[model samples]
Target: MEIKLEEKKIKLVLIILFLGMILPIFLTHQNFKIYDSITKALELWDKEHLLIGMLKLVIMNTLRSIPMYIAIFLLFDSIEIIKNGRKRNFEKVLLILPIIPIAYSLIKIFYDIQLPVGKTSILGVLWFCYYVKFDLKNITYVEKYLVFLSFIVGLQWLDVSRFFNFLGVGEITSDLNKAIIFMEADVIVTLICISFFSFFTLFSILLLHFFKGQEERIARSRSEMENRHLKEVQLLVHDLKTPIFSVGALLETLTLQEEDERKKLYLKKMEDSIEKTNVMISEILSVKSEKPIVIEEMMRFIFSFLSVHKNIEGITYKSYLKKDYKLKGNRILLSRVIINLIVNSWEANSSVVNIMVKDYKKRLIIQIDDCGDGIDIDNINELIKEGVSTKNSSGKGLSFVVKTIKEMEGKIYFVKKIKNGTKIYIILKGDEYGE
Candidate 1:
């Protein structure tokens, strides 16, 4: 609702703030002071006070550069969030976000026009954190190279002087130099050094950014490969888990028929071991399961499954929904989550299992109600994390449940109920079900 909309608006404002910071310097470089866009820009520079004027230039330039890195960094970090109607990649999305005040700043700085910016932004803070997290090592490498580049720039500045015309652009002519009263050798030489340094500084920033991007790309590729390997392992585990359960059942049948008492005991132990092995297999398969089916029929299939596997002992199960609900996701994975939740409830001495469903625009809000000794308040969040277990068996099953919900972009939270039962709410987004 309004809160979500406001959050998006806030992020948009921050983006503009960051974009504005870098716009001036980039535009200045590109425009070459032809003096068109922001003609008032030079007003900020006091020529009579050269120190103030130089400070104005440096401050404005750095302000503009910081946000450029931030916008670029966030663009990469959130590349996968393709929401609403935009399916654009990170680069395309950033391109759509405004250009680095390129042509406009160039025209303005040359004409001394100031570009007015609106509002404050945290892009400076955002980029500082990001650089420290991911780019510092690479930036240091670039800085080390920049030290050598500085010397080279100084030598090149010399070549553009006297008879050593490396760039032959413009050197002091004797007649023009004599006409300028303030043009002392010291002042002119200082200006040349400043300009030379500025050029090298900007060049180094761009080079560092480019290398940082390369490092990120390499990191992502390595991550994707690791996920691929994990998925392969998961599939292999799935193949192994299903048959172990069947083998366990076969062993149970043999145990009942065995005449020797010792042999029967051994058969029972084998059956128990097979069952334990099967659970482990399930845990492994849970790691890499794919998207769930969202059809109404599939949800029905899941309810029917619970009915078929209804506890023959002291446990009881109930389907509380009035009508069928539809969700897009892997039915198998969803079923596993449901089974684990129900098993946990049963273990907590709950005889009744209530599955309630409600329509939430495009989403289906499902709540599983269990009258049991609810989750430990302190450990609720931890239970969802990997390797966290509240049960006697391997903790992977509960971790898998949390992982599955996250994969679907859904959320799960433990609710404090007036009644003694625990309420676990699962919110599955409508858009995800379609996809």
Candidate 2:
């Protein structure tokens, strides 16, 4: 099965490659007796047979290139996958399955050359790549490291006589073949192992950098999509504005013309509905728009908005307004703050939510008091934080409230807290209260 490569798996593959190279280099340098014995045999080999001598030279050169080729191929591909996610076609590394061992087998027929087990090494890695589907992001580092170690241990030392048979190469099983083959086997294996380790480690570092870079790209893409969606919604909402105004105007004209009280009342309800839609459109537009809102006028809208929820079981509200207060800020933002606080009180099963708008010296104090369970002592300190909501939602309501008030150059405080409920104070400059 073909598996798509992800960042973490690409990293693991690189580490396995480097480890494969490093361990063998260290082992060969320790004067293993096999190396000493292989040294004497290589010197005595038949330099007289021209074809065999040429084949031996070819095998040696090919063997030298194979490790470097594998390292470069795997390293470069892994980096490519990171930069641009999964590929549409097959990976290039699969070419090693047929090519490397077949080339080695040509030498095996005449010289009995000991080729590093390309079959096992490449197959093991490819098998892992296929199995992992290249997505190792969710796994722990320990599990990831263990898999890395297992690939080196299992495939690098794999022994199989049929590796030659699978490629349809005739194995020369004579005493001479065995002697020549086993003579350089240890040294060849050691060199391949060290090469694998050295290259794997070097490329692993490069893969890690690209992997992190891939994550950043994904995040940026997600954010851009969200921004585009927001823009589209705003445009759609803006398109809705004109029709809503026409409907509201039609309702007002009907209300003025109708002589019957019942029909006029119905028209009035329709006007209210259109006004609500208008306010909704205004709210959507005012999200990032800096618009001034009359506090007195906004309070009426808030009262109308809250009246819909007042009939909710156990919720009740009252308002005290001083009249004619104005503030320079986003109306939608101010409306959101009021609605959010009312919602908190409503959801808390408040028996009464008393809203007071007062003129105290040079400040307009809008206070809301709810008769329900008071704010938690511990939570009160963090109550204005985005996530601290009575309904246990995303908790952004109060945070938005605090932010909007700050933008209006205003202040808010939790003035009273008791067994019954809590009171919140919103204070704005008297200068903001225009004629």
Candidate 3:
């Protein structure tokens, strides 16, 4: 099923992807070979010692692998159903099925059970192909972590970590006289296999997430700098406009005062030259002169403007300013955002673009909806990125939307329907709601 990639459901998918990649090898680690490896490695090669090490590996492997594998399948299927956007009951019902795998894993780990009679490598490989092609990586976190897990586990050589007795409990000891299930595998071998896959699985997730966050942060900082640069260029152009306009104005005055037709024409020519310069400056300045402020004032101005625009009579803009939520943007910059959205909506053939404030749970939500040609199928997200534009814009409107929202310490995204227009959703932290 096509699970829409939303932020909330990321963790579940990541867990599944991780397990699908790592579990088979992980569970197999605790199989019979470990008993031989440890017994041989330690020179305690007799049956008693072999059984002891093998049993320990089996128990520990079961403890880590069972619950983990169960978690993997449960979360994976839940995410699958959610991705499909299917009937809720089946998703809900299927959610609990993870418990059985979890129970199996846990019971094997913590309780005394004969190791199941199958080679675990087959299980590992089966789960591999299951997730490999599923490719549910439209989500960022999933894409980042799953790829990392698959790569690390692929070599099958970097197996790491062994003991996990954090439960503070020892394994249940079998009586000395009892023969364990037609034991084929050794303890140390199983432990090594389990340790390799299990450690790689667990550790790789933590590592990938940590790095992805850092990379995102760095990317964000780079983006913010670019916006600041845009603003800076605007400042430089705005600074230049006054002198250019002054020169053009002086030339215009000369043309009005001149009695000689030739001189009048020449003065008019100079006026035209500098006038173009002034126009370019204005467009440049129009985007650059920005500061930061609270959200309400901006909405108030936009809605107030929309209330009067004769061309926009059929369209309505609404505001939902929360009493306590505040944003880190100033009036001028925020006003520009409202104006741009309104204009873009109108341009896109939408009779109306709804602009409203909402309590997006703990965060503040500023939503812009328009019944226009929804965003271009391919470039909705592209537009928010720097240097991407449909109109060959100063290429700044939506980028401005993104920049301003971020300056306000918020985020903005477009949910565009394939046929209709788009919904621009911005979530901002105010008093960091539910903080």
Leading candidate by lDDT = 2
Whole-model lDDT per candidate: 0.53, 0.56, 0.54
| Residue 390 displacement in candidate 1 (angstroms) | 7.8
Which candidate number has the best TM-score?
3
lDDT at 19, model 2: 48
TM-score of each: 0.43, 0.40, 0.45
How far in Å is the alpha carbon of 435 misplaced in model 3? Answer: 24
Model 2: per-residue lDDT, tens digit, 194-257?
A: 4554455445434444554665677788789968876898899999988888888888888898
**Residue-level lDDT tens digits of model 1 in 125-213:** 22233343333343343453453343334333333223222322221122222222233334654576457656765674565567678
Error of 2 at 346 (Å): 1.8
- Looking at model 1, residue 117 earns an lDDT score of 23
**RMSD of each predicted structure:** 12.1, 18.0, 11.5
Q: lDDT tens string, model 3, 198-239? A: 665666556555655666777788889978987888888878
Cand. 3 Cα-lDDT: 0.54
Candidate 1 residues lying further than 4 Å off, grouped into runs, are: 1-228, 231-249, 252-327, 340-354, 369-399, 409-423, 429-435
Better model by lDDT: candidate 1 vs candidate 3 = 3
Task: Report residue 51 deviation for candidate 3 (angstroms).
Answer: 13
| Model 3 error, position 20 (Å) | 3.5
